[model samples]
Structures are given as C-alpha cells and as structure tokens.
Target chain A: MPGTRARRSDAEVVAAVRAAVVEELAEVGLGRLTMDGIGQRAGIAKTSLYRRWDSPQAILLDALQAGFPQEQPTPAPTDDLRSDLIEALRLMIAWLTTPVARATGAILAERARYPELAEAVYTQVFEPKGGRFTGTVLRHYAAAGRIDPDRLTPVVLDIGEALVLKYTLDSGELPDEQTLADIVDQAVLPAADRPH
Target chain B: MPGTRARRSDAEVVAAVRAAVVEELAEVGLGRLTMDGIGQRAGIAKTSLYRRWDSPQAILLDALQAGFPQEQPTPAPTDDLRSDLIEALRLMIAWLTTPVARATGAILAERARYPELAEAVYTQVFEPKGGRFTGTVLRHYAAAGRIDPDRLTPVVLDIGEALVLKYTLDSGELPDEQTLADIVDQAVLPAADRPH
Candidate 1:
C-alpha cells in the first residue's frame, strides 16, 4: 500500500506541475513566468521543478504539448471530406474552452511582446500536433487520393479553423453546429477542390 | 492669439482623452476601466470625460469607431476583384498594427467576460466600417455585376480576415505579400466565385 501511494503521488505531482504552468502563465504572462512561481502554485519544492524541467518555459511547453488535441481522420469506404473538415473545426471549438486553450491564447495575444515563447509554442506544441486544426484532415484526404494535392495549400487548409476563430473573436461565443456546417460547405469545401 | 490657443487646446484635450481610453484599456483591461483611471492617464478632469461620454465603455466604443478604417472599393474600368480583395486585406493588416487595434484585441479577447462590450464593438465599429475585411469588396463587385450576389455568404465573406488572423496567431507575424496573395488566390477568389 505504501509503495502504491508513492508511485501514484509521483504522477499527481507531474499533473499538478503541468496545471500550475498554465495557471502561472495566465496570471503573470509569458514575460514574468518564473520557476519559483510555478513551484509555489503547484505546491512543490523549487528543487523538484529544476530536477525535471530546466526552466519555466520548458514546463509550459511540455504542458501545452501534453494537452494539445490531435485531429483523428478515420479511413473508411465512404470517407467524407466535408464532414471531416467540420469535425476538425468542432475539435478546435471544443479545445477553445479548455485551460490549455486559454493558456495558448494568453501566449499568442501577447506574442508581439514575447516572441520566443510564441515561437517555442509553435515549434514545440502546434507543429508536432499537426500544424493547425483541419490540417490533419486535409493531409489525410490528400494521402488517400481523395483530394488533389495542389488544393491543400496553407490558406485552403486554414479556412475552417480561421473562420471559426474569427466568429468566436467577433461574437465571443463558440460557433454552433450550423455555423460549422456552413463553414465546411461554403468556404472549406470549395477551396479543398469541391468547387461550388 | 489667445482665442486660437483656446480653440486648439480644446481639440487637444479631446484627442488626449481618446488616446488615453485605448491605453487605459490595454493596462487596466475592460472590467477595470474607470473615469478616474482614464482622467488621470489623460491628465484631464473626470467631469470633462463625462461631458461627452456616459461610461468608460462608451468612451472605448467612441474611440474605436473614431479610429476604425472604412474599406474603399474604387471603381476602375477593369475593376479587378482580385486586387480589390487583396487591397481590403492590406487595409486590415495596416489596422492590425495600431494602438486602436490592440485595444480592440483586448476587448474581444476578454469578450467572454464582457459580452456587451464585444457586441458593441461589432455594432459600433466593425459593421459601420463594412462588416468585415474583404466584405465591402465582395459586395462592391457583386453590386457591379462582376460577381454573383449569392456567393457573398457570411462564411465566404469571412475567408480573408479569418485566414490572416489565423496566420498571425500561428506565426506571430503579419502575413507577407505572398501569403496575402495566396489567401486571395487560393481561398478568397475561390469562395468569391472565381472557381479555379
């Protein structure tokens, strides 16, 4: 029983540290993130933090990557590209309501003030997670020969997520299912080679 | 000479107060905005602010609408829809680098906390300034019979600004000339009825 408690507590400490980095970044911003602050917020010793992570930024990056969602595009006899794009956007909308999403927004909103942190987020978190929302699905379709490779430009791939983001930024609300369907049918499908 | 100075000082005071509202929103955020903070920042009397505006949100809305740029879709013999769409995005990029833009970001970013303020930004600033970037151009071309009116759906109209905002959020830099053109050619034109 004592040994089980020791192993479980180790996992708990790691989870606490991950959550603390996000909360810390939100409170102090990327510029003022400190190891001590993270440790205090997680209720761990500062030395314990240094043992695992070299700095506060590293821990934050680890947290972001750990929490970042991956879009799953299932291969089927009847794979629907339109439905897939909308589904990817739905994943994005769901992510928007999370603590990690808020942390990502915090880092990005002040990106002009803290360039390297933002860069690290891209290189470490988003890039490894499949570039951007809807990107994975597009790539999946392209690989399966369902879509023309030429149509999968960066701008085309970004249409669904981008419009959903703009909608949220303008309205302060997550897009509804109808909005997602509209995005897929009107903007995304046409650019993804499904012309009109 | 004294009369001219009095008239100039009055204009100067209004300008200072307008600038102060944006700066105060940046530092104190929307919820913390107050007459005392704005007056102290602008170095003016609180009574002077209330003379023209009823609340801090009122001043923010007024300042935003004052600074908001209108999209100008010029008519030429050729009247290139592609170039006009690109130009509209260029205007949006230019606006993205301003103090007012950052103030707008602060409001929209915290819109989940202040829904009314976000809605006010739309009704007061953006809708009056041609809905969204690329919106006026699409409408202009549609009205001129260069584009099909039915193609001007909300999702299609949003493709350009949404992509630019997503690009900036991802890369922490404004989209380059090539990137903007890609958005037009790959995304905007296709949705606007170009149909490659």
Candidate 2:
C-alpha cells in the first residue's frame, strides 16, 4: 500500500498501530495477527509498519506497553508498609486480570521466535512499571528506617517477578485480595523490618 | 514401518516415545522438534508416533512427566519452618536451573496448541511436588500448634507458582540463595508463626 498525502507523526502512527493491534487481537487471536492485517486495520501501509516495528511481535509489545497506565499512580503510603504493599498488590492483581494480561500471555507464547521483541517488552514495558512500583514501596520502607536500601532491589524483583509470573502462567486468575494481603503481611512487610 | 514380531505394549511405546522426545528437545531446541524427528529418534514408525501421541505437545508432556521425580521428597521439618522452606527453595531453584526447566519452558511455549498438555504437566509434575513440599512444612507447623492447616494450599500455590514462574520467565537466572532465604524468613516462617 502507498502512503497518503497526509503523513502522521511517529507518535500518532505508533498509537494508531497499537490500537489496531489490540482490536485485531480481540477479533482474531495472536496466531492470525500479521503485519499486513494490522496495517490494514490501522489504515497504514505495510511498509510503514515494517519500517518502525521489526515484526508483529514488536507491534504487539508496543500495544501492550501502550495499554498499561504510563505513570504508576502513587499509592498513598499508609505508614504501615504491609498496608502500602497490599494496596500496590491489589492494583497489580486487577491489572493482571484484565485484557492486557491476556495479550501479554499471547505475546509471551510467541517470544521464542522473536527474542528481541521479548527483551524489548520486558525492559521497556513490564520491567519499568514493575521497577517503579517496587522502588516506591521499598523507598517508603527505607524512609521509615526499617530496611536497608541495599536490600530493596533484590527483594522487590524476587517478589514482584514471582507475583507477575504466577498470574501469567495461571492464565490471569490472580491471587485473591486476601492472599495479596497475606503475602504483604507475611513476606514483604517483615522483610522490611529493621534487623535486631 | 509395519511391525511383524510382537508389537510393544502401549506402556513400552509411550516410554520409548517420551525418551526420544527428551533427547530431541535437549539436542534440538523446540523450534526444530517434530513428530517425524521424534519417530526417527525413537525407532518407532511415524504412524505409531502420531497415533499414540496426538501432537508434539503431547509427546513433550509425556516426556516431562516421565522425567519428573516419582516421589516428591518431603522436606524434613527442623521445627523451624523458615529453614525447611529455605531448603525447599534451594531444591526448587536447582530444579528450575536444570535441563528439566528448559524442557518445561519449551513445552509451555506450545501450550496454546496443546492446552491439555499444559494441564497435564501442571497436575502431574508441578502441582504434586509443590503440594507435597508445602504439606510437609505445614504439617510440621500444625503438629507444633502453629498456623492453621487449612491455609497451606493457598500459601503453597501462591509462593510455589510465583517462584517457578519467576525462574521460567527470567530465562533460567536462578534467584540467589540469599534472596530465597529472605523469602522463606519473611513469608513462609512468619505465616507459620504461632497466632498470639
């Protein structure tokens, strides 16, 4: 397909493409998602699609990233780290149970064939959101003089990664609110407690 | 490819096919794996392979089940749930970093085409081991008059699923022992602490 006289900016193109991909995914599953299909749906030329995103996987990653809330809405710290962590977990669980999470699983299934796309999605989208949430919670604990700042990264990564993976692998039946509360109270909050 | 002399029993055929699947997955990654390849590797007729295992996914699931340790090793409870959990985590980390984990991931990638295989592997391989380990620790805690026995399943599933998923999604970078220790100390032990 040839480009029209009206040229869209890169951001506009990306946004359009991303929206089309999601709509396509809902209509036709991941197996049938193709660049040309997405291009047609987005009213963009296939050439334009390929020029920006290397493959359908890249486009799908872009779609997922765009779908998630860009700014991590700061959960007001409750002073009690356990409550704060629970709040974060609740929001994450809700997100994971949404359409975005389904699309993520579909993308992950295709990841082996497109390792670069997988890396891009992980680093650009999933990791950043996860890191931000983890960082904020850990920072709150550190400010209270409860946990060593050094322990933040590893703890957050381990727990956050685990939670996300569990939900994904389980096909989005996220841990219930009670379980989330239990996890924070039992694991996360205590881990932040000042050492004897 | 017709068998003349007494055909092998279904069990024997399943064993041969499963062994061949493992060998192929190990030698050639998931992308290159095929029914013909498995048949040739197993010294079985292509027809026999197709007839027995519905798809490559089925073959891989069978292989995973065959490879999984028959007995879920019970972690000896040292009356200290934390240490027991740490030991369990160590064992889990070791398993996840091994060839078994790699094969499991390969099998998982094909889950969309073979949903049954995913369920079978989850039930036969993952769930049983996780259940036994958690049960052992929880039983010890129960015997000591600590946490409620009813809570064991949810705890085990949440934590076990998370741990395994983290390892899988992270592409085999096993969480360090210290991280595992912290998880046990904070989550498992505290959850098992006697109710005041």
Task: Tell me the lDDT of model 2 at A125.
Answer: 78
TM-score (all chains, Cα) for each model: 0.87, 0.64
lDDT of 2 at A122: 74
Q: Candidate 2 residues A1-196, lDDT tens each?
A: 3354677888888888888887788789767889989999998889888888898867887778777643232444535566666666666666666677667766666666756666776797767665434456667667667677765655443665465456555552466677676666555554455353
Q: Write the per-residue lDDT of candidate 1 for residues A1-196, one digit (tens) a residue.
A: 3344344377899999999999998888778899999998997889989999999989998999989899988678779888888888988888899999999888877788878988888899888978888899899988998888889887887888889988887766799999999998888877886632
lDDT string, candidate 1, B86-115, tens digits: 899999999999999999888877777888
Q: Give the whole-model CA lDDT for all candidates, comma-separated.
A: 0.87, 0.65
- What is candidate 1's CA lDDT for residue A99? 96
Judged by lDDT against the true structure, how good is candidate 1?
A: 0.87
Any runs in candidate 2 off by more than 4 Å, and if so which? Answer: A1-14, A21-38, A45-62, A70-84, A97-113, A130-135, A144-153, A193-196, B1-17, B20-66, B70-84, B97-138, B141-153, B176-187, B190-196
DockQ of each: 0.73, 0.28
